[model samples]
Target: MGKSRHEKRAAIREHKEARRDRCESDAYLDANSRVIKAERNIPWWRR
Candidate 1:
């Protein structure tokens, strides 16, 4: 049998949610890497 309307909507919602979650994690990792790079660049006098 074909999927009901509710099932189709639910699948679409799940796909969107997964995409959003991946984007958020990627942003977090990018920010963290930048911070680490900045920390490594600090001069000994400033630490």
Candidate 2:
């Protein structure tokens, strides 16, 4: 069965949190800004 709206929203929230944590870890490890932005799916104009 398909997930309900609330379930889908929760999943999205969890994914965002996970990505944020990864970005922070990458920053701590001296990962490139471009690479971190790419992971967060940020575009050029947004920067």
Candidate 3:
């Protein structure tokens, strides 16, 4: 199943927090953000 609303929000929030922390490398953050986008767009049934 696709991510639930709570899961999606959590993932987005986690990514935002990571960006704010500035601890991880830019490449890592960029890749993570891309993953969020990819997962977020998936249809529930398809997931």
Candidate 4:
């Protein structure tokens, strides 16, 4: 049997929420890596 309209809507909402969460995590990781790289570049005397 085919899914009802409400069921289809719920599935789409769930998929969107999942995608948003993944994007947020990826952005966080990218920002964190940049910070770490910058810290590594700094010399001990300056830090």
Q: Who wins the TM-score comparison?
A: 4
The list of candidate 1 runs beyond 4 A from truth reads 26-47
How do all models score by TM-score? Answer: 0.53, 0.53, 0.45, 0.55
Across 1-47, the per-residue lDDT of candidate 1 in tens digits comes to 99999999999999999988887797788998999999899998997
For model 4, the stretches where C-alpha displacement exceeds 4 angstroms are: 26-47
Q: lDDT at 7 for candidate 2?
A: 100
lDDT of 4 by residue, 1-47 (tens): 99999999999999999988887787788998999999999999998
Clashes found in each candidate (C-alpha, N, C closer than 3 A): 0, 0, 0, 0
* Model 2 spans with C-alpha error above 4 angstroms: 26-47
Residue pairs that clash (backbone atoms under 3 angstroms), model 2? none
Candidate 4, residue 27: CA error in Å? 6.1
lDDT of every model, 2 decimals: 0.92, 0.82, 0.91, 0.93
Clashes of 2: 0
| Model number with the top lDDT | 4
| Location of the lowest summed lDDT over 10 successive residues in candidate 3 | 19-28
Candidate 4 to native Cα RMSD, angstroms: 6.5
- Ranking of predictions according to lDDT: 4, 1, 3, 2
Segments in model 3 whose C-alpha atoms lie over 4 Å from true places: 23-47
Which digits, one per residue and each the tens of the lDDT, describe model 2 over residues 1-47?
99999999999999999988987786665667667767687666887
- In the predicted model 3, the residue pairs found to clash are none
